[model samples]
Target chain A: MIQVGVNGYGTIGKRVADAVAAQPDMVLRGVAKRSPNHEAESAVKREYDLYAADPDRTDEFEAVGLPPAGTLSDLLADVDVVVDCCPAGVGAQNRDIYDAHDVRVVFQGGEDATVADASFTARTAFETARDADAVRVVSCNSTGLARLLAPVAESFGVETARVTLIRRGGDPAQTDRGPINDIVPDPVGLPSHHGPDVNTVLPGVDVDTAALKAPVTAMHTHSVNVTLETTPTADEVRRLLADESRLFLIPEGAGIDGAGALKEYAMDLGRPRGDLWENCLWGESVHVSGRDLYLFQNVHQEADVVPENVDAIRAMATDTAAAESMATTDQALGVGLESRLDTDTELPDSITADD
Target chain B: MIQVGVNGYGTIGKRVADAVAAQPDMVLRGVAKRSPNHEAESAVKREYDLYAADPDRTDEFEAVGLPPAGTLSDLLADVDVVVDCCPAGVGAQNRDIYDAHDVRVVFQGGEDATVADASFTARTAFETARDADAVRVVSCNSTGLARLLAPVAESFGVETARVTLIRRGGDPAQTDRGPINDIVPDPVGLPSHHGPDVNTVLPGVDVDTAALKAPVTAMHTHSVNVTLETTPTADEVRRLLADESRLFLIPEGAGIDGAGALKEYAMDLGRPRGDLWENCLWGESVHVSGRDLYLFQNVHQEADVVPENVDAIRAMATDTAAAESMATTDQALGVGLESRLDTDTELPDSITADD
Candidate 1:
């Protein structure tokens, strides 16, 4: 069995640990926590072997009734692959440590693009993760854009892609962020850096991205406009998006208009924490004028990348093909099994349980 | 004072009555309802002179503990302009009645493009509403697109405009209608007829619009993609949008993301029914790639056209100029006063009370 260790226990880290536990072919070696905080307690509650990133902070865990399993060096030596969920820029700092241990690694989106040989977002360019010593999963926004753009790019050659990201202020747990009653331009110069992040995963497409952080923290909604090389009918575009398993095309009449009802639908389906793992696209909103395709979709900022990280793990450690790995990931996590999981369905034809 | 009568006390009529009441130069003559329903009772509570559209149903108001209102003919005789808020096709029937009384009329979007002399969306084409015998206000969706596009068209000519309308199933009070769980393609045709509605107002620009109805009632979100005649940077486009009084540019870090939080912001500011009179545009979402301009903004279906109706009243009945009429309407309604209305403002500079 493949052994995996998580180096951080924050938003993405805790989820990575749980996802590793769900994998049939993987055994979670352990997880590393910087402080003996509430999250450290959670790591222990899941029966994960806990290690302290700093040797001096090991006692912090012991004082909180949870003994540390080992030091970060020791954890690195034991696990075949260490999924680095450390804070931004810290991944680059830990690059030397990971190389010293000669352990394979997977980094989150927050890390700079250079930390990994190539940025990873499955389905869009899953093969890019293959045989790489280090891989970084693209940010939630990039993952969403890749997932959406890949299908279109494949169906019709894209000449130019433009996206406006309506971002949430912070994760639901992040209470320290501000601008509670105003909208400001973040990194307000030119094209946002998100386009380059998306390019790391999908380089062939010429893309421009702009973003705004809103006060609410539910999910990020993307307004995508793609100018394609070929002109397809609106129906053709709708069907193309509906075919992708990772894309949940919200059907009309389904009362699921925006992110609020989409979240409510997930909770109604008994999803853990009402998390919608798939990119929620309003199918009826997909329209094609001339060669341009326009649509609005919501990406659950915290949860979307969870499945992508799992796929990246298999891509790195195993010789699994991109399609096969994605299929296995989807089946294991129940990613595209909306019809079977949903007890109450408003649309007879809809395929996702997240509604 | 310009006297206006509203025929049909449904979603659009009640708001029109309230807006007319708030206008400095306008007085609401009365509102006509077919039956003494809950909405009609609301009209009475607001002190609007309620009239019965159906002469046979005059007793319905008295039976519901509400006093009788004059007949439709009597209401038409009193008001200089009759804003027809009747259902689809019903406005066409009422057209003859309005003409016989020699009173000017304003029709809602539900009526076809040919229902009036010309469809009007103030600011986009306030001149079209000028001294007309009859005028129909473009849809909430049209109003939003016109408001966003007019600036772009004026500054940089618009080659093409493509929009995808994520429409609400009904008004907040409308609970009986919906797909309940699906997103279906409404009017499953080429353009969904919204483009034609836009054309009736802005004839020079080539626009393509598609629409789908979601089970939401709060508001309709529009995904707009416009290819400009000249290529401008993202910064120039953003500054242009921010200058429009009718457009509220939701900046980055303001934390107001989705329709839910937007509604919350409105409620917090103590607006009646959490109504946002202006189009809520995510400022940071405005981006330019080559010549393409992309944006995402929401149109509050119930309240967006309320201010427009008042402007149309001034345009048709009074000798008020377009700019003057819009300014008077904006001030009386307490619009452009976000900073003042909001006790807790993240934006230190905004003066509008209705953020």
Candidate 2:
């Protein structure tokens, strides 16, 4: 079994631990936490050997009424791979921990290119991190735009893409978000730079993206306008999109509504906790009139990237073969998380098996 | 010369007055205001002989250092058409006003059906209002959806159109609009009554719409998921859309961004005011992949519907020749109101000329 240890027991980290533990090929060695906060205490109560990062906490382990788990050093001792679910901008510090432990690390989006020494986007940036010890899953927006644009770019030869991304100002933990009742312009700058940022992952694509923060937290819905060098029929295009496994095309007869409906659908499907692995795509909303086509897609930031991280982790741990990495990643991250969050149930067998 | 009088000088009304006055064939007879507030007095300085709706201020017409433009009744005396820019459910009162003066009246969407005898929409709703002296402009969402859906329904037999309307919480004026930062489901229940309401205009087509109010006042964007009975090529559908004068297809080659770019293009084109007569459609964004197609469109509520109101007015006025009336209506409305709000420069003769 591939021993996996998760450093950081926050929302994403905890979910990662549960996901890793659910896999047949994987065994969760332990989970590390900061100090004994309410959340950390809860993790400890749930039988996760929560390790405090502070060395001082190791000396006080007995004095504090907590479990007999050791420090970060102890958690890193026997792990093949580590999923660093630390806060944004803290990946640099975590990188050192991974380097010191000589373990492969899956870093979140908050870290810079220097932190991972590898970029892990499916399309543009995937090959860049091919040999690097660390891999980074992009932000939710980049992943979403990249997925949609990749197929179009390859098949149709994209001329220019003008997209208006209606992003939710609040993350799951953020309480205060928005000018509440107003739709402000993305940023008052040309190209908004999000498109260029996406190009970092999707090379050779000329994309100009503008982002507007709306009063939402669940997902970001993108109003994408793409100009293709070659025209493709809407039907042909939908077929191409449906080919991607991560993309769940909202079929014609399906009565799904917005991102909320999509999230609820995944949750009902007994998906991995948080159900972030699936891309909620609407098929009928994909209208291609002439060389131009329109598509509406909802990208779940926290959840979508989680599975990508799982893939990155597996790739880092085993040559287990790149062709099999994607399938393994989905199996590792996609299934049980949805069920856990929904029914509060433990790991289910269907999800743990690699397809 | 066509004499146009505005009854309520609010956000839309003031723009209408300036629009009418700028036209060579139409003359602004005067405008009706409540009382001589600083804003109203300033309107008088711009030569809109202000009148009062308050009965008590009937005689104060001469006392306010203004012309004897009379009360709301007096304002209607020689006016060929009166445009009611009043609040919701109140524009119905203009029916009596129109009948008394034996002139057609243009009503905004704010007026409920009970308030007005008939509704005026670009998508054949005028057929229902064909007999009335009053014609009502449909709500912004209704108007935008109807215009986009009409051709689609006619060409490919609409199976079902599921639309998620992200509406502005309130107009720029209203203080309290919504659940603030929360994404609240539109409480009115099932397949929003809007689709049914549109069928009133187009009898055979079946459509469904859901509305959610965001906290912004600029423009309302729709996430439209439509499944047609018969599938057509995306290009074919785009060609049909391109044929419509009010529908602008944002082609792919341009470096333009979102609807904002479309708005700027309209402004540069010397439209009557910076109002858009057609839907600022993203042409390249219309994607037809397989049987599924996607499209993104921006509806400028204040701008797009303004000219439609003018069209409905002319259509309602000409009782003898329906075809001629509609033909004139299309041309008049197509003059492109994009120039009106551009810069403080007079519009080009071709755009400002009255039909």
Candidate 3:
């Protein structure tokens, strides 16, 4: 079994730990906590070997009515991979921790793209992590764009891709993230840094992105406009998208609602995470009129990226077959990739990379 | 045969003319044009009586664009009803033209609610024009909210309805509306006026609306979240919605896109107006999770209000039975009501108010 350790236990971290527990080939070696607070106590109850880093603060958990756990150094000794689900600015500091222990570390979406030597969004940048010891997952917006753009680019040569991201007010944990009641033009400019950020993973794609933050928490909706080198009918485009496993194409006559269908369809598909994993596609929603086509899809900001980290880890395990493994995983998990059905129901060892 | 006159030969005016001409009970009396411009010439070539409204003026088209064939006074003499497809602010000025000619005129949605004594939207305010000789149609956003909200409210007792309107950027005439590159907030406030505006038609419902304008054309997409007065299953709500005739419920398993299916569904239905005479509900898109239901629906701003204008005219033609006729037309049109069959059949008497 592959030994996996998590270095943070916040909202996304807890989910990553839960996901690791669900995988058949993975085992939780241990987890690191920032403070011996209430969250740390809760983690301990879940059979997680919680640990702290500061040597001077040995019994912080006891002072907070918590059980005693080992130090971070002791936990780091045995784990093969440590996922740094730490807070945004702080992940850069923890890079030294991974280097000292000589173990691979995975960073969350919040960590800046510059934090890691390589960024991992599964669709765009998983290959970059093949030789690196640490990998940072792209932000939710970048991940979503990568997923949608990859298939469209592959199917039709992309001349230009433009997107407007309608983001929610805040994550449940992001108390400090801004104008809560009003819709603010985030970045307030064209070609938002998202295009460039996504390029870190997908180097050659020329894309422009814009963003807005609305006062709701359901999910982020993207209005994407792709100018293809060759135009395809709406039906043809729908067929391409519907062929993907992670993408759920909503039928036109069904009168399905947007994110509502997205969450439900994801849940109904029996995804491991509830409405948190997978992307929802409205099949008939993609409209090709003249040279233009329109579509509506939803991106669950937190859960979609969790699996990308998993895929990036596997890609780093070997270089010779990294591209093929990454492509296979994207086919399995990325939205809008055509599903390939073979005579054999199960993938062989040649295709499966142990992360 | 009822003689229906269109005063403008613009995009909506031409469609209105076509819709009226298709009906057996209606006769296309003639179309008025301010100038013999290319579009007006096209309307004339279609064998519509093309009369220059203002021979004395050079830019006759601008002055008489909405209801295109002739001067308001000229159309009043022969036509029983006149559709003021005129530009915004011009509708109010032409109100006297309808009054002097002693002809009932139907105004487009551009004019505010205060444009006429009564406003007609398929959603809430259709009844307000029951006895009035002249009426206004509510904007596209109100029309969409009314259709979705009425069903959800009646079945689940919606505590509050909050909606975010993703409006297409350009006017129908503007060609660049497609391939939207940016998403902008309508304004920086909660409870946008769109929800309040809907109350005029709905009477006693409370809704909060926020709008964002994106650079795409075709239709407006709304992301709505409703807090129910009582909890219910998503399937129950979807069933309740699917029962509505004017609403073509997009099915679940079939992959469908939004406006693309809606427009095609309307066309296939042979709807007299081509698009829906009422709002199009997204059936498969609706999802319910623990009393919280989500979905997205499309509202054609220009074409949807056309039929309501017809209904309002039918009411004015017989004032003693105005309320009765309004109710009849509302039921027939399935406004503020639900009908089950997903049949694509057009009403026999479906025509513009000019008829």
Interface RMSD of each: 16.9, 28.7, 27.2
Q: Write the per-residue lDDT of candidate 3 for residues B204-313, one digit (tens) a residue.
A: 77788888887544478888888788878777887787666445565432123555334433432324333455566566567776667788877776566655655556
User: Which ten-residue region of model 1 chain B has the weakest summed lDDT?
Assistant: B346-355
Off by over 4 Å in 1: A1-355, B337-355
Q: How many Å off is the CA of A135 in candidate 3?
A: 1.8
lDDT of 1 by residue, A86-123 (tens): 77767788899999999999988887888888889888
Q: Give the fraction of true interface contacts kept by model 2.
A: 0.00
Which numbered prediction scores highest in lDDT against the true structure?
1
Could you estimate the TM-score for every candidate? 0.50, 0.47, 0.46
Candidate 2's C-alpha runs over 4 A off are A56-65, A123-127, A177-179, A272-274, A332-355, B1-355
Estimate, for each residue in A35-94, the C-alpha lDDT of model 3 and write its tens digit: 554345445656777776555555655555444467777877887777877767677888
- 1 or 3, which is superior by TM-score? 1
Computed on C-alphas against the true complex, the DockQ of each candidate is 0.01, 0.01, 0.01
Candidate lDDT (C-alpha), each: 0.77, 0.63, 0.62
**Stretches of candidate 3 above 4 Å error?**
A36-38, A53-58, A173-178, A253-255, A264-273, A318-355, B1-355
**Candidate 1 at B135: error in angstroms?**
0.4
lDDT of 2 by residue, A1-355 (tens): 7888887765567667766776767888888766443345445545777787667655333344555477788888888788777777766777777889888777776666567777666544545555777777776677778878888898888988888888876543344346466777768676786786677678788998887887665678889889888878888888887777677676543234566445434433334432556566677788887778788888876566666666666666666654476666666555322111111111111100000
